[model samples]
Target chain A: MTPTITAFETSPDRGQGLARDMRVRWSLEEVRQPYEVRLVSFAAMKEPAHLARHPFGQIPTYEEGELVLFESGAIVLHIAQRHAGLLPDDANARARAVAWMFAAVNTIEPPILDLQNAKFQEGDKPWAAERMPLVLDRIRQRAGQLSERLDDADWLDGAFSAGDLMMIGVLRRLRPSGLLDEYPNLAAYVARGEARPAFKRAFDAQLAVFTSRQPAAG
Target chain B: MTPTITAFETSPDRGQGLARDMRVRWSLEEVRQPYEVRLVSFAAMKEPAHLARHPFGQIPTYEEGELVLFESGAIVLHIAQRHAGLLPDDANARARAVAWMFAAVNTIEPPILDLQNAKFQEGDKPWAAERMPLVLDRIRQRAGQLSERLDDADWLDGAFSAGDLMMIGVLRRLRPSGLLDEYPNLAAYVARGEARPAFKRAFDAQLAVFTSRQPAAG
Candidate 1:
């Protein structure tokens, strides 16, 4: 059965592929798993039906029969486990790869998300200007540490796993700030991820959604 | 062989188990695994040796023989995977459990971490007072959704899995502000987590670290 996942009918990022669903799509593409999307409007997402799949009322929520799941990291991990290419064969390597995945979402992404709050969400607040720099600095700190670790390595661990997929998604959130350019290596890392065939498929798919949303200018 | 993890020589949370390492420790206790703690001073955490294991220079890195991993969620997941009780036998249920693990760190923990920044790191900033409500509101939003979904469920899924262990850790961060009290269900949920014998053991272990740090009044 082709698994179905939920995505934002109108993403806040408007097809940048920065939405969490993009991560799920990329994972499915990586695994060569055919899947379908159920687009949920913002209002529909907050309703009880969607909330059952994702208590937080967010996307993307994965469903295959009775098995329903939410959270991109979890969904990606599930795909990686079921499929072969995304996880390592060695138990230790597999464990380390999963660790990096967690690091991407938990450690590195928080500050970047804070930047989101400081920028778009709270941009008009009286404190926005003063608070944003501090938030960006925090993000930079995380990026700098990550850049240092990446140093010359292509992937975070031995191989390109779900860890890299999640990391790329998290770091891409910083593109709007242009702060990603400050770390050339990190920027290149994100570029490498986007260049992946699977990532390209996911990106183009999301962009198509945005293109459809745009009304004819004539 | 028992896995060894790192902790703080002196925690910024003053031994409240609010530090990242506490999560790892709690998970270890939950799975009934015996582990060793290798404490590192804040200064040492920035050194190359520590950074090699954990690129971000943070606490609670896991090392079991040749297998070394960072990120508390990763470490906890590793422990859960190796143990019998923390995961489910069914493939789909296991996937759902892992999703909760990601939700705990990615979705639920971000705003709660922001509260830490507002209260501890950025408390002196001019806008700290004004900005706190917005941060709290974000956390409340997540908490509200989580409470609604958790309405009378013994745990997130059928059995108590690593997901609950991670979620309780995230929710415990809100105890200081008493924001969790606003959600009776979540409050009871956290209490239920705390009441676990393993959780009590983990809490006492972490509290001991705090009590040991008490200043000499003389």
Candidate 2:
């Protein structure tokens, strides 16, 4: 069965592939799984039907037969577990790959998310200006540690597993902040991930959604 | 062979079971797995040895034979996968449980962690007092949504799984904030988790570490 995943009817990022649905789409492409996408509007996402699918009422929910899963990390892991090419065969390597997945979302992404909250959510607040440095510094600290660990490694660990997929996805969000450029290797790592054929296919698929919704150019 | 995990030489929370180690310990206890603890001081956690085990240099790192893992969510999931008690036998249920684990750390915990950063990290800043409500409200939004979904249910989903374990661990951090109390059901849900015998054992064990280090009364 071809799994169906939800994405924004109109992505806030305007098809920048920064919204989490990109992660699920990229993972499916990597695993060579041809799936369907269901675009949901902001209001519809909060409706009872969507809320039942995702308690948080967010997009990128995965539904296959009786299974319904949310959280891009979980959905991506689900795809990786059921298919090949996303995780390594060795048990230890697989476990490490998963560790990196959790690190990407739980460890690295939180600070990045904070940067967003500071900029968009609290940009008007009086404290936003002064607090911006603190938030950026936090991201710098994690990115620096990650850069040190990567230390010219192609991926986080032995092959380009789901860990790298998720880590690169998270790091891509930092491009606008310009902090990623500070770590040359980490920036290149994101570039490498984006260069993958699977990533390009997924990126184009989501971008098409936004492009199609735009009014025709005069 | 018994696996070894790391904890703080002196927990900042003083054994309130707030540190990530408690999650691993509680999961191990739930699975009836005997394990050893390796305590690391703040200084030691940043050293090369600990950094090797955990690139981010944080506790608790799980070392079982040849496999080493970090991220409490990953460690707990590892224990859940290897042991019988923590994950549901059904594959779909198991995936949902894993989703909850991600939700706990990613969705729920980020705001809670932000509250911490606002209070402790920038508590001395001039805008700390004014900026506090925004941080608290973010947590409340998630807590409210969670409470609505949980309703009167005993757990997030069917029978207690690693999902509940991780969600409960994350919610426990909100207790001091009082935001959790706004949703009485969520608060009681956490109480249900604490009432578990395994939770008690885990809590007591971590607490013992802190108490043992206290100065003797004259």
Candidate 3:
């Protein structure tokens, strides 16, 4: 079944591929699944319609017939479970991969989101300076742990699964801060994720959204 | 296989059932699955052995034979997938339930955790008073969105699947702030989860850990 996924009509990230939809796109690309995109504007996102699809009214809601799914982590997992490449064939390995998926969003991503808030959400506030380091510290602690676990491994686990897809997605958001560089192996790890042809295709597809929207040269 | 899980030696919430382990315990109880718990000290959690089980050095890591999994969301999902009662028989419904799991942690809990940081982690800072409203606003925005989506529904999807289990666990954290009371249906929804016999047993079990640790009431 072809799933219909939502994305920002005019993304605030300016097509950095940092949007949650990029993960969904990457997951689909990894599994070689053909899907459809339905873009929604910011104003339309908060309306009852999008909210009906996603309680939080966020983009990247997946609709496949009767099932309406949100949360990029879950959407990717759903796709991975049905498809083969994103998950391992072994039962135990599959559960571990799922653990990495949750770790990426719940454990790893929260501090990253806190970092985003420190910069974008609260950058103008008087506390930005005072609060920024604290946020950065939290990110450093998590990144340090992740770097240690990853060590010299090419992927988080046996092979590239949806777990790496989610983790790299979260880590990519950290590039603007340059914190990812502090841990050389993690920086290399992110580079490895980017090197995947599937990731490049997804990145270019999302980036195209912004490039196409760019005003014509004078 | 009887799985083993981990929890705090003395939970910071004072047996409030706010720890991620509560969700795992609740899930085990719902499936009527017998399990064992191993308590970890804060110092031990950061040590190498526990880090091996959980890179994040947090509680609620699941181990059954060779399969060691961390992240309460992932653990509970693992249990639900392997057992009955916690998930729906319908494949699509199960996927939707998984979406709620991600929503509770990713979309819902981040704002809640920000509120936690504002109060517990950063309450000492000079910006505490001025910056708190921003965190609360973030929480309020998410809670308001959740409330609208729930809209008098008994569960987020249907029939109290793991989705409801996760959402309830996330919402229970808000009780101390009284924000949950603002959303009557959501508050009742949490209450209904608490009233379940399985939830009651899990709550009592975790609460017992704290009670057992307390010094004699002198």
Clashes of each: 0, 0, 0
Over the stretch B1-218, how does candidate 3's per-residue lDDT look in tens digits? Answer: 89999999988999998999999999999999999999999999999999999998999899999999999999999999989998899998999999999999998899899889889889999999999888888888998888888889888888899999999999999999998999898899999999999999999999999999998897
In terms of lDDT, the best-performing candidate is 2
Q: What's the CA error at residue A190 for candidate 1, in Å? A: 0.9
- Writing each residue's lDDT as its tens digit, candidate 2 over B1-218 gives 99999999997987788999999999999999999999999999999999999999899999999999999999999899988999998999999999999999999999999999988899999999998988898998888889989999999998999999999999999888778878889999999999999999999999999999999889
Q: Which residues of candidate 1, in runs, are more than 4 Å off?
A: B213-218
Itemize residue pairs with steric clashes in candidate 3.
Answer: none
Off by over 4 Å in 3: none
- Better structure of 1 and 2 per lDDT: 2
- Whole-model lDDT per candidate: 0.89, 0.94, 0.92
**What TM-score, computed on C-alpha atoms, does each candidate reach?**
0.97, 0.99, 0.98
For residue A33, model 3's alpha carbon misses the true position, in angstroms, by 1.0
Off by over 4 Å in 2: none
Q: Would you give me the overall lDDT of model 2?
A: 0.94
> What would the per-residue lDDT of candidate 3 be over residues A1-218, giving only the tens digit for each residue?
78899988896888888999999999999988888888899999999889889888887999989888999999999999988899999999999999999999998899999998888889999888978888999999999999999999999999999999999999999998999999999999999999999999988888888888889899
lDDT score, candidate 3, position B50 = 99
Docking class of 2: high
Sorted by lDDT, highest first, which candidate order results? 2, 3, 1
Q: What local lDDT does model 2 show for residue A85?
A: 97
